[model samples]
Target chain A: MQRSRLGDLTAFNQLVERYQGPVYNLALRMLSYEAAAEDVTQEVFLSAYRALGQYREGSFKAWLLTITANACRDLLRKRKRRQETSLEEMVETSGDRSVSPSPTPEEYTLRREVQREIQQALNHLSHDHRLAVLLVNLQGLDYGEAARAMGVSLGTLKSRLSRGRAQLREHLLTARGTREP
Target chain B: MFRRRSEPIRHQRVRELLSSYLDAQASERERELVERHVATCEACRRYQEELRDTVQAVRGLPQVTPPRTFTLAQAPRQRMAWALPSWGTPLATATAAALFAVLILGEVTGLIGSPVAHPTAMPSSEALSLKALVQPEAAPEPTPAASDALESLAVQDETPPAATQELSRSSADTSPPPPEEAAQPPLQVPLLPWLQGALGLLAVASGAWWLRRRRAIR
Candidate 1:
């Protein structure tokens, strides 16, 4: 981290390597659009590099996730203001998965289906609630870290997470029921 | 009857706790309460199971590979830091100052536009006659030769206004010019003022732009 702060590209690259997956995944789940998520992930790292001076002693992952969360919020707000988010446009553009193929075709197909449902469920949430769940459960951040990333109190974070989880569970089950029938 | 009424409240509280409980984030007391409640309450247990499954499903999703590595090719930020280089504002300020100086110098030297009105240039005697003649706002009827002489006196040297006034008197005494001759148009207005005004505006605009850019960069 010191080296990266000193403007070491290799050190920063290592940080990017270690954290890109979580950042990209968070963005993807938050946005439910592959291209937009990629764009946000790139933007997050650029800002992280610029803002490294502002980072005090804390969890670097949480700091990076905070940047990711904020960027996602800004993009979502902009998208909303422009009235540019259409369900059909999102579905059409978001289905192109560049993730490396899984070991088995059947497993990959099933996982992709499930992941799509999860992404759709996440999209159905408010930005705060989706971020809360993504940080705590999906990104594996603890309650305190997730709270810090979301800039909310632990109680508020937990409330958002609980609400988010309940909503997500409902959506997934509904989708499953419809799919099966 | 009280147990039945409190049952639904307890169920709601336990359901709220179920999400945190699955993450092992509940307090020890709350954890114990939720565990005991879920153990006996079929509805709370089912809700916990569903929430747990949802969290697990989210966690289990495969990591999406980043489409490309994000290590900036070059320090675009460093480039941005240098975007308005250290010398930029200084250069802009210097340029604006220079332009301002040029404008002031041009005005003082009468190079930019017609010289400021020279009220005291005419001699006292000539001034009385000139003022009397101009009082009626009638154009002077100096002959063509007199007009030519006035132009020459005005242009040939940086003569004080008194000398030109004397010249006009001598010419007026020699031959009062025809009204037709005196009906010539007044001196042409110089375009230099417009040019100088534009330059001044450019200087101000450049300074403003530099200040704005500097603030944004900071």
Candidate 2:
């Protein structure tokens, strides 16, 4: 971090290489779109690089993820401002509800179906709840780290996670029942 | 198990505990209590299992690799380049101050020579009155060209102490001008030098502070 702050491009790129996957995935899940997630991932790294001086010591990953979360939120706000529909609406409109070709293995098909259902269920969550779930459950940050990354208290994290999980479970179960037997 | 309906508050608390327990985030004692309660309680056990599955499903979502290396050759360097001007703010301010001091000094020494102070320039009515008061004996009805020239010179000379003394001498010869006109103090003091010195000090102080901040950041 010190090297990067001193304008070392190699050190900064090393940081980006290490974190790009998690950051990209976080954006993907939060946004439920590949292109938007890609843009946000780049934006997050660029913003992090410029703000390297302001970064304090702690979990670098948490700090990076914090930037990612805020960047995603800002993009979402911009999308909202364009008189565009909510993220859920975007997800629903772009979502693949069509059945896979039979030539594909049934197991792979089922897996893809489940993935889509999970994404749709995630889309139903409010932005905060979705972000909490993405950070803690998907990104594997513990509650404390996730709370810090989300800039919320631990108690608030727990509440959002609990509510988010309950809603997700309900949606998944309902979706599964409708699709499967 | 049927008695669980009578303890709604306890049921809610246990449900919250179960949610945390599934994440392995519950306190040790809370974990123990949740474990014990779920063991005896069918509803709580089912709720815990469902939450656990939900978490697993989310975790099972495959991680996607970024479509491309979100890397750039010179973006950060470009940002640094843009920021270079921000660091030059103090230097710019100091340069501006120096230029302002030069202008003021030139104005004070009449080196830059304001057009308003030229002898051939037209004099306002007030300048004519002051000129009449300063040089009462020169002309009661001087020619237009001479009066205009004399008024201009008188206005230009009005900045010096010698000019004020000359006015006092001329007023002594007259029946004494109105008190308001007499009470007017000379508009010029050694203000230009004082202003130039203050500006120089400010420029030095600003440059020093900027250097100190740059050192601290380094």
Cα TM-score per model: 0.62, 0.61
Per-residue lDDT for B1-218 in model 1, tens only?
Answer: 34454888999899898888887889999999998888898888888888889999878766667777777776645523544545767888999999999888766776556533334432466555654443234444555765675667667767547745655664555544456434534343375666777888999998988775433222
Ten-residue segment with the worst summed lDDT in candidate 2 chain A? Answer: A92-101
Winner by TM-score: 1
Stretches off by above 4 angstroms in model 2 are A85-89, A92-104, B1-6, B77-218
Which 10-residue span in candidate 2 chain B carries the lowest summed lDDT? Answer: B113-122
The digit string of per-residue lDDT tens for model 2 on B1-218 reads 35544566766778877768887889999888788888898988888888899989998887776778876577564443435354466566667567677766766875543322334332354555666554454334444565455456656775645444444344444455556444444334344566757766776775665564332222
CAPRI class of candidate 1? acceptable
- In angstroms, the error of model 2 at A62 is 1.4
True contacts kept of each: 0.49, 0.47
